[model samples]
Target: MNNPSLISGTTFNEIFAIMEASFPVSEIRTFSGQRALLDNPNYQLFTEKDTEGKTLAFLAAWEFPELRFIEHLAVNPDIRGGGIGNKLMSSYIHRSDKPLLLEVEPPDGELEQRRIGFYERLGFQLNPYSYVQPPLRAGQADLPLRIMTYPQAVTLKEFQRFRDILYTEVYRITVPSSR
Candidate 1:
C-alpha cells in the first residue's frame, strides 16, 4: 500500500464518500458536523495515499498557533488491520510542530480498546478527566468523550482549555441544540 495524501475541501466530498462507506452513520454524522466548522482557513486535511496515488486514509485538524486538535481520523475498513492508519498519524505528528489533541470514544468494547491502544502506541496519553461531547443532532444523546494528548507532558489545564474552545466554537456550530 502507499501513503495517503493530505487534502482539503478541494477534494473533501470525494474523501467523505470513503469515510461514509467505512464508518458508522453516527460517526459519519459527527465527522460531517465537525468538518463543517474546520472548513475555514485555519484548518487542514491530511490524507494518505497508496502506491497508486489513491487516498488510503485521512486525518483532519484545526490549527491554532500553539496546538492542533485532530477532529477526525479514519482508515478504510477494507484496509484497517494494515499500517495505513499508523502511517497517516505518524505523518501528521512528524509534520506538526505543536502539541496534538484528540477525542476518542471510551474503551467500552474490544473495538474501542483496540482504538485507544492504537493511539497509545502512537504516544497519546489518556487524560484522567471526562467530558460529554455535544450531540450530532437535536435531542440526541451526548457522546462520552475521552481526551488523548500527544507530547505527553501537556497540562490538564491546557487540555481543559482546548476542550472548552471545542465545545464553544466547534460544537455550537455543529450541534447547536446541545448548547
Candidate 2:
C-alpha cells in the first residue's frame, strides 16, 4: 500500500475509475475537484496495488493534529467480494497515530448493516449521535449517516468537534441540520 501525495496520471485515472464505480455521484467530488485535493497538506490517498500494478483498493483520508477522518474507501468493482477491503483497512488502521473516524449509512438495510459489520470487524464502533452528511456537491441533499470511530466510541463533545472539522475543513460548509 502506498499513501502518496502526488500520483501519476495513469494511477489517478485507475483509482478514479474504481471510485466512480463504487460510490454514488453525491458521495464524491468531480474529477478535477478530486485531483486538486492532492495540493492540500492534510489529505492522503492510500492505494493498494497488485504486483502487476493494478489498483486493488484505496482510501482517501484527511489528517488533523488529533484525529483522522477517512473520506472514501473502495475496492475495484471487478474484484468485489475479495479480501482486499479487509486487508486495506487493516493496513490503514495499523498506521494511524490518533483517533480514526469514518461515515456509514444507518443499518436500515441488509447492505448497510453488512457494511457496518465489516467495519465493526475491523474495530470501528458506530457512534450513536445523529448525523447528516453535508452535501458533497452543490444542490445535493444532506445524506443521513452515522460516524464510526476506532479504538473506542467518542463522547458527544468529541463527536461535535469532529463534525465541526468535517464541515469547516473537509466539506467547507456551514453546519447543516441533522437527524
Best-matching candidate per TM-score: 2
TM-score of 1: 0.79
Please list the C-alpha lDDT of all candidates, in the order they appear.
0.72, 0.89
Report the C-alpha lDDT of model 2 over 41-114, residue by residue, as the tens digit.
98988888999987888888999988999999999988878898888788889886699999999999999999
In model 2, the clashing pairs are none
Cα-based RMSD of the predictions, in order?
Answer: 4.3, 2.2
Which lDDT tens digits does candidate 1 get at residues 1-179?
22223355545665686778765555545556645654476667777777665777777677777677887788876788788789888878887778888888888899888988999999998887877777656567777778888978456678767777777655654434433
Task: Evaluate residue 15 in candidate 1 and report its C-alpha lDDT on the 0 to 100 scale.
Answer: 64
